[model samples]
Target: MKVVTTEIPATSAPPTLGVLLAGGLARRMGGGDKPMRSIGGRTILERVIARLSPQCSGLILNANGDPARFAAFGLQVVADDVPGFPGPLAGILAALDWTATNRPEIEWVLSAAGDCPFLPRDLVARLHEARARENAQLAVAASGDQSHPVIGLWRVDLREELRHALVVEDLRKIDRWTARYPLATVMWPTEPLDPFFNANTVEDIAEAERLAALDDAS
Candidate 1:
């Protein structure tokens, strides 16, 4: 299927449902919910909500296993339709499928890694702007030289294509898939701690404590 896009709305950004990608089996963080780990006296998931909730019309958690694990977050948890935990693309596809079925009026899905506590407030606005400016098929976040594909804007219309990539082609690398279309990478500053900082291991959690202090001071 062709990956096409319509003109972005010039008015306020369209209603977008934010999907927090938390379907990972975090073996690096001892195989549990990394976002549930605390930082700055708050769970990382709480900080993610504080940072991302305002930018979108609604939020959902994309996770596998028991939906009850994220019951406290009070989100509509949607697991991947495809089996075998096919990486972040599966989570993205789940969100896209949910948007298509439940919110046909909403044309966009803003996806972010559940572990990133310091996501930028301007994420939705900036991604919309960059995608429109570049006339790109998608917009992803970047800090310094790194690209955070999991944290990005997805067109709901492209759900079928994404599903094909994940299921038929078994594509796992985000870059390899995104390379097929025009993509805009919105760059963020690393100073004062990168807004895309993610905690994956015990040591990273300690570093997050330090960054949490810097995040509060900023």
Candidate 2:
């Protein structure tokens, strides 16, 4: 892959939409919406919304359900267009298609895991900067040595290609599909707490509580 590095002007970032990926089965968390779990006396989804709302033109929830359960959040809820629970890629595609049809002016969409309550405040800006610096077609967040593929910025124009990859080609892994494009990675420090730390089980929730206490202290 060719990597072109350039400085992204402050005004160059495109109008972007935020998509919270909450389509997981959460089997390890006892089979409920993990985003709905409470931490620091608030639903994880609420923290996610609070963190992402200011970074995008608008926000939507990409989940598979009645949408009523999430009605309290008051954001538009979208479900995967491809059936059979294809995974995060499918949710990303759903957000892309939704943005294409409903918000044509939006050229970029940021996807973040709903279960991650402490997503970095500068997530969108940094992703945009990295993509601009690398002239990359896609950007994903990384910390330590691990890349969080689901937390990414995608061009709205690639919706059809992604749809084909998911529906026709049966591609499910986020990293596998991302490898075909010019990918820019933006790394965040993992001290104090990993911004992308997600709750996956009962114990994880307890850990989140401890982290929440730390977050409050800071």
Candidate 3:
């Protein structure tokens, strides 16, 4: 299905539901949720929420296991619809399904890694602008030459197709599926720090602390 890009003014982009993809195994960071890991005294997930909440009409957490662990955050936590810890694509599919069921009026959903604390403030606006400008069904964020497939805006209308890719076709790689669509890429500067920078290891957390200080100073 071709998604007609909404021509709303960039500043008034369509109401978007933000989904935090936190359903990772985190084996590299020693299992458990990496977003829960603290950076500069605040949990990564807390910082992620702070960055994305204002940019979205509503926000939900895509996580597995017990929802009560995220209770203090006061956000609705939805689990992946595709089982076996299929990865971020599964998380994205779950977010699309959730938005379709709960917020049917919203046609777009923006997803970001929960472990990414430095998400740009202009994330939603820029993605929408790029999608409209390119007339693409999907928009993914990029820094320099690297594209972040999971950090993207997805059309809610494409949820069924995504589910088919995940369940029937067993497609797990995000880029592989996104390759089939008319995808727009919005690039951001990596000078201060890549806005999509995520903490995948203990050392990365320390680096995030230093970067967080840099971000605060700037």
Give the better candidate number (1 or 2) by TM-score: 2
Best by lDDT: 2
Query: Which run of 10 residues does model 1 get worst, by summed lDDT?
Result: 1-10
* Whole-model lDDT, model 3: 0.89
lDDT of each: 0.87, 0.90, 0.89
Residue range 89-163, candidate 1, lDDT tens digits:
899999999989988889999999999999998899999899998999899999999999999999999989988
Count of residue pairs whose backbone atoms collide, per candidate? 0, 0, 0
Considering only N, C-alpha and C atoms within 3 Å, which residue pairs clash in candidate 1?
none
The CA-based lDDT of model 2 is what?
0.90
Cα lDDT tens digits for candidate 3, 73-154: 8788999998899999999989988988989999999999999999998999999999999999999999989999989999
Ten-residue segment with the worst summed lDDT in candidate 2? 1-10
How high is each candidate's TM-score?
A: 0.93, 0.94, 0.94
Runs of candidate 1 with Cα error greater than 4 angstroms are 1-11
How accurate locally is residue 168 in candidate 2, as Cα lDDT from 0 to 100? 91
Which pairs clash (backbone N, Cα, C closer than 3 Å) in model 3? none
Reference-based TM-score, model 1: 0.93
